[model samples]
Target: MPPTIEMTTTWERTCEVADLEPGWGEVALLGTHQVALVRITDEEVYAVTHHDPHTGAPVMARGIVGSRGDRPTIASPLHKEVYDLGTGECFTDPGLALRTYRTRIVGGMIEVELDR
Candidate 1:
């Protein structure tokens, strides 16, 4: 048997939970990657890639926040391509998908797990 390797998660502090308005998207720069931070409720926050896969534009911060059933979603501001905030699944187009990041709140600050 080979030696097991443990993966370490690096969480980057992005912003305060109060900084994000519910039902709106805000852009945060995590190193070289731009992330779209969305606040669905006071206790619920989500992070996704700001780059729109279909248009190749960094405009997801301006996307519309909505929901498909009980799953929270965000729609591209340019072409209206909807994506699942938690899974990064594109509902409108199966070929394209947005990237999602894990988010947590500590001391009222929002931290995102960088995709590595």
Candidate 2:
């Protein structure tokens, strides 16, 4: 079975390091904030708000994972807006941008530092 991550104070422990799959995104709820976690590689992971800035729909988690040059990105499923996984910069529309949170792998577990 896929391992799960439970909420904790300060840094929220996300899914197990193995729970994150390469080339995919997963959504985790910490209180009311929805976080989209993307696994680019075994050593890399990124977290962003699941809310699509264009349509304001919480569907970024369902967005397609890809990259522009060397910049990892997630394409909004609702409007096809692409956002930078590292900086949350919207490439499709520079005017609209998403929020990015800090992430790390600790002790074989994925942890996200909630952006407050």
Candidate 3:
């Protein structure tokens, strides 16, 4: 079990690290907020608000994960908009991106850091 990382005020037990397969994604509800947690690599994971940056709809979790010139990204299934998995920066447009959250694993549990 890894040591827990204290971020913000409340601590959340989101998912188990083993439960998340690398290169795959998962959606979990933390409180009233729906979030998409994506595993981009063996040690890198991204937690983004499930709402789409373009439509404000919860669909980012269904987006496809891929890479563009070594930049890991997710292509929105709704509009095909590409977002950087690491930074949540949109690739198709200059100023479009989904809100990103901080994530860490503690005791094999995935924890998300959200602003309360």
Candidate 4:
């Protein structure tokens, strides 16, 4: 058995549950970090570093969401680089990836897990 990793809630309620429609991405500031919270499907929500992994630009949150084969990904609006929403892994470079956060909806509010 492995040691259990504890997940702690980081972000406060940035937006109401109604504020996020299905299949959309929004930028929210959690502490000092900017995060891109995306609704991939009706049941799935993903949180990733808003900065574009390729250009070091803060614009992934505005990227369009789609799938490459079966992997749900977001295409950067600046350079069209695709990243896996779940893992924040660059589709072109596996070694290059974004930091991903745990996201959950509770009491009609959405929160992202933060590293303390």
Least accurate stretch of 10 residues (summed lDDT) in model 4? 8-17
Whole-model lDDT per candidate: 0.94, 0.88, 0.83, 0.80
Q: Considering lDDT, which of the candidate structures 1 and 2 is the better prediction for this target?
A: 1
Best by TM-score: 1
Q: Order candidates by lDDT, high to low.
A: 1, 2, 3, 4
Kindly list the per-residue Cα lDDT of model 2 for residues 34-113, writing each as its tens digit.
99999988789999998999988889989999999999999999889899999989887989999998888998788888
Off by over 4 Å in 2: 1-9
Q: Which stretches of candidate 1 lie over 4 Å from their true place?
A: 1-8
lDDT of 3 by residue, 25-91 (tens): 7899999889898986556778888898998888888889899998888888898999987788998
Question: Could you give me the TM-score of model 4 versus the true structure?
Answer: 0.81
Best by lDDT: 1
Residue ranges of candidate 4 with Cα displaced over 4 Å: 1-11
Q: Which residue runs does candidate 3 get wrong by more than 4 Å?
A: 1-8
Deviation in angstroms for 1 in model 2? Answer: 55
Compared with the true structure, model 3 gives a TM-score of 0.84
Candidate order by TM-score, decreasing, is 1, 2, 3, 4
- Assess every candidate by TM-score: 0.91, 0.88, 0.84, 0.81
Candidate 2 positional error at 80, Å: 0.5
TM-score of 2: 0.88
Per-candidate RMSD vs. true structure? Answer: 2.5, 8.8, 7.2, 4.3
Give the winner by TM-score: 1 or 2: 1
